[model samples]
Target: MLDDFMTRATLAGIGVAFAAAPLGSFVVWRRMAYFGDATAHAAILGVALALALELSIFAGAMAVALAMALTVSALSGRGYAMDTLLGVLAHSALAFGLVAVSFLSGIRIDLMAYLFGDILAVSRGDLGVIWSGAALVVGLIGWRWSRLLTSTLSPDMAHAAGINPRHEQLILTLALAITVAVAIKVVGVLLIAAMLIVPAAAARPLARTPEAMALIAAGIGAASALVGLRAAYVLDTPAGPSIVCVAATAFALTGLYSVARKAR
Candidate 1:
């Protein structure tokens, strides 16, 4: 099974979807889309760091993504507007990462693979890492579901319930870093946030409850992965973007459904 690239790619996509679904829901609820983008973009810096230090790319990506997320979380509410701060950090990290990559003299790295993913080249070890990260994320989110929900709904309410909103936010930050690390091989840095948001956005119209939204988003994400891989193979298109395109299409269709339902 692992010998087949398509099978591996399919499993990788499903694994990422599982991890992203719950975290994506929290991101949407907290209005943290920019936050997600910033963290993902920082993965490039991780790639550079990995190459320079001869460490695992996954380790480098996760470390930098964690740092980026923590920085954003810390800097938030320190006077700068959220959007402005994220915009500055996101682009700066990406630019610095690109510069860092250019400094790697002897390495013959393919930037496009990191920037846009190389899911079809995933190995059995990569699949193992993806599934492990996915399970950890899902377990972490599930364990903190109620508290996270309460904090997301209202910080004050969460404090009253003896839950620390900051702690919950930290948990999410950790989860986001893990997701970025594992998903870099599936959708790459440029489109990771789309995979995180679009499926959740698409699921919104069909779900009446938060739990339902997470499940539906997971389904949509997994479906997009499978469909996108087939489309890419048939059309000779890039696999990562094709997956994101399917998800974007789902978002558009669901948006239309929402508007129609509201009118009728």
Candidate 2:
């Protein structure tokens, strides 16, 4: 029974890591870490809504994340600094979500589990949601890969080639929303951004191209999930944080290697 439980948990974690890595590569490349955080922070509101309305948690998060992404994208065009707006939105949404969650009476919800994650508690149904959502996100990204790469390199160039940067941005925003929704259940809202960023960051120094970075990031994320799971089982530690720690350690090692290569 214990073995079966562990197997399911590991499989779920692996699926999540695979999905998070490629999307996260773009998040890192586009410097959208803060945007991811803002969307994730808003998930608490989604959770609250889900519980109150008896809706699917995934659906609730997707709705909230999409709304938040649209709001940020619209506000980004208003001549304000993106970082400033993101900071305000991220923290404000997190604070508001916390307060909103507190209003639920007669229910004992472990806020920490939602914030930091409870990967071991993932159900088979949740795994199905994660895999399906991830596949959709990957397909969308694949369809627009060239356009996105062009836009990332130079929006002017992309425009000259007749690729609409705005449309690509919208597509990316949608993908980010889906990614946040799926990943929240794996790493929780507070740490979801880390899972998105750290593996990609670790892969950056080792990659010569964007595609290479994405693949490397996926590998790193998968390895981290496996290793972290083992460590968690052995040490009786929390799974989510253990996974993130492994990613962080990989990032540190990569950074060191990059520095050494630079010096040589």
Top TM-score hit: 1
Candidate 1: tens digits of C-alpha lDDT, residues 1-264 = 788999999999999999999999999989899999999999999999999999999999999999999999899999999999999999999999999999999999999999999999999999999999999999999999999999999999999999999999999999999999999999999999999999998998999999999999999999999999999999999999999999999999999999999999
Q: Give the TM-score of candidate 2.
A: 0.96
Which pairs clash (backbone N, Cα, C closer than 3 Å) in model 1? none
Q: Please, what is the TM-score per model?
A: 0.99, 0.96
- Model 2, range 1-91, lDDT digits (tens) per residue? 3247577677767777777787888888789899988988888888888777779888888888888888999999698899999999888
Question: What local lDDT score does residue 26 receive in model 2, on the 0 to 100 scale?
Answer: 81
lDDT of each: 0.96, 0.86
